[model samples]
Target: MKKKFLVMSDSHGQNDLVQEVIDKESPIDGLIHCGDMEEAFGKDLSFPMYFVKGNCDSRRIGKKIPYERIIDVCGYKILICHGHLYHVKYSLQDLINEGISQQVDIICFGHTHIPLITKKKGILLLNPGSLAFPERGYQNSYIVLTFSENGIHYSLKEVMEY
Candidate 1:
């Protein structure tokens, strides 16, 4: 069996982008939202999504779907969170350290609206950033992770507006 994930974060209110990405991408097994997806958008998302609570997430949204501290994504045990709760950006090292302590194979987060994929102490850290408004000033994109029996590969796909 093969495993593939569609990852996005910080929609801020852009639900159409989510739909656009899903429609355009090939096959994907799951979805991960690093959060700040406004309530209006999150509710109507058509795929299975695991999300963390961003600082901007309202109490209502949090109450409806509490962010999971850890998850088993594909064959990998992952720590998933919005970086604000973990103090990212200024301290990615610290966040990675904590993920190591938690014995997670992958650490996924979003908050800085910048994409990053790096390894530290055997842990893979990934930030898909904002799929709606990328701070990088390029087009909005999402990271797709594909897992096979041999290994894992990732590709970033930008959404095209119709």
Candidate 2:
């Protein structure tokens, strides 16, 4: 089976773009929000969403999001988190080490509002960036990931409209 996932985070209540992205790109099997959504996932959400609380989040949704979870996505083990807890930008080495310890195939996190799709020590580490305030020099963006038995496939989509 193929597992398609919509990965995002840090909306801070601005959901128009996010909602548009999901609606236009339907049939997503899972949604991962790396926190700071202001708890939008609990409301107006109709997908299987897994979220984590960011520093800006008024509600600690990550607690309910089942932290440190190992999800099986088409035989791939995915580890998801908000990234702030792992000190994302400053140091991803710790996060990578932890992922290795947990034996996960992919690790996802968001905090610096910078999207990334890179590998460290053979493990995939990704950050979908901040959707609401992406004006921090880079285009507002998100990611779509297709996990397969062979590997994970993905693409980046930019939010061109306000």
Candidate 3:
């Protein structure tokens, strides 16, 4: 069986934009939010969703949401985080080390609001950027991952402007 997931991050209270992305990418098997989703907590969606708390998230809500999560998707282990705890803005070594320790195949994080997809030491690192506030000249973006018997394929997608 093939499974598809939508990955996004740094929404920062823009629930409307988040909803827009969910609507645009309907039928996905799951949704992953790397966080900074100030207003997105408790919002309902059609698909199964996983989330981590970002630095910008309120302390009250942060208590309820986890700082990181590990999940299995079609035999692939994925780690999701907001990246603040790992100090991603400085370097990925911390995050990389964490992934290694956790034995995850992929690590999804958001903080810089810049989209990125890279591999280090056999682990895939993906940042879907900011759906509400992109930075460094990048447009609002996200990622779509397709997992199948063959392997995992991904696409970096830009949100369309109305």
Clashes of 3: 0
lDDT tens per residue, model 2, 1-162? 677899887788777777877887788888887777875544555568777667877454445554445677777788888777777779898899999999999997887888889999989887887787874788778889987776679887787774
**Model 1 / residue 135 / CA error / Å:** 1.0
- Flag the better candidate by TM-score, 1 or 3: 3
Candidate achieving the largest lDDT: 3
lDDT of 2: 0.78
> What TM-score against the true fold does each predicted structure earn?
0.88, 0.88, 0.95
For 42-132, candidate 3 gives per-residue lDDT tens digits of 6766678998989988563547689899999988999999999999999999999999999999999999899999999899999999998
The candidate that achieves the highest TM-score relative to the unseen native structure: 3
Residue 148's lDDT within candidate 2 is 74
Assess candidate 1 and give its lDDT. Answer: 0.78
Candidates ranked, most accurate by TM-score first: 3, 2, 1
lDDT of each prediction vs. the true structure? 0.78, 0.78, 0.91
Can you write out model 1's per-residue Cα lDDT over 16-92, one digit (the tens) per residue?
78778777774667788887886645444444678777888866365765554788856688887888866786888
